[model samples]
Target: MSETISPAQFHRAPGVTDWRVTGTGPQAVFAARSLGEASGLVAPVVAAAERFGVRPDVDVRPEAVVVRVPPGPDGIPAAATDFAAAVSQAAHELGMTPDPSRVQSVGLYVAQHSAADARPFFVAALGYEELGDTDAVDPLRCGPQLAFNPITGDVPSRGRTHLDVFVPADQAPARVEAALAAGGRLVDDSYAPAWWSLASPENHGVDIASWTDTTD
Candidate 1:
């Protein structure tokens, strides 16, 4: 395995213009004409992974092909940059447009301040494994990763669990605008470009977050 690198470093590498650093790691989206066109990318993606000895997650949609390269325990490995570039090249060869706007990570956060231990219950119920100190992840990659945050139990208004949308810095504002127009109200934008906590019409909590300073 190559040395681990920061998100900014990976983003600045050549041929990664179509990629973004999500909550997990480097990911890219390519617009396709149809599912058939999207499916064509899988073979090339797998070949790239095999060449680099790293496994990448590929999701084919009717209009897009999303690829996520899982990071190492510490951070993204330098090898991922080359792998990402290969994927981007393959996408262009197929006449697909690189669309970084659609790349984002949707994670769940469970704020527990009660006395009883809830991690065990969640582990068994959700079939998750411990991911660092305050997070649980599905080994099968079936669902979004869940984070356990420390918060005051007295604040019922803050809610226990919330959806976190980790998107590219360049696309954060647009995403927030679309959500607000969808009937959700902004709870807090003090963190602007970093994150925005919003609430649905029913008061369900959701946050749009970004880590990169800019998309450059």
Candidate 2:
């Protein structure tokens, strides 16, 4: 399992609902009815973040804008909360819904006989920068984080890698059902609420998970 960041470390302000903290920092996704709305959000959101002195990674999708606020020097948690608040207010004023529940982060897991030997190839191929020894992350924060897992024995016939999708706790059940409807087979669900491991029609593994304990 990857290292888990405690929920207490991700402080949320009063008006900022649905923002989540991951390995990256506090992240929120606002839903736009169309591409036009998504585009329209850029200027105001950027302006708001700048006003708060926070550098945010803003990804404009066809129907959403994914915002990731990086931890700051003074206090990462507080900074993240402030940044989220500003962005949330901007989004709400623009008729956008703070559907952070729909926000998801994916990480690519590559199982290798020797992680060191395999790491360089992926980093160079994807033009991804290294995040410590075992992971490579996209500098622009648009792509998924790549994690190298070392396997002891013979590699599996299916593949050496899989995808892990992290969603908000409340959305996991619906996500799992949708995956099943799409012909995905449940591999394991004993870890319920933490993660649900499933295999695609092609037998590729995809684990839908919640990074924080959201039972509360």
Candidate 2 lDDT tens digits, 116-204:
35778888999999877688888877788898877767554433888988777668889999999999999999998789999999999
Clashing pairs in 2: none
Where does candidate 2 have its weakest 10-residue lDDT segment? Answer: 1-10
Model 1: lDDT to the true structure: 0.86
- Most TM-score-accurate candidate: 1
lDDT of 2 at 31: 89
lDDT for each residue of candidate 1 in 69-156, tens digit (9 for 90 to 100):
8877878878898999999999999999988888888899888765444567788998899888778889977689888876655554
Whole-model Cα lDDT of every candidate shown, in order? 0.86, 0.74
Best by lDDT: 1
As a whole number from 0 to 100, the lDDT of residue 185 in candidate 2 is 100
- After the best TM-score superposition of candidate 1, give how far the Cα of residue 69 lies from its true spot, in angstroms: 0.7
Candidate 1 vs. true structure, TM-score: 0.90
The residue ranges of model 2 lying beyond 4 angstroms of the native Cα positions read 1-12, 22-24, 34-36, 70-77, 114-116, 155-159, 212-216
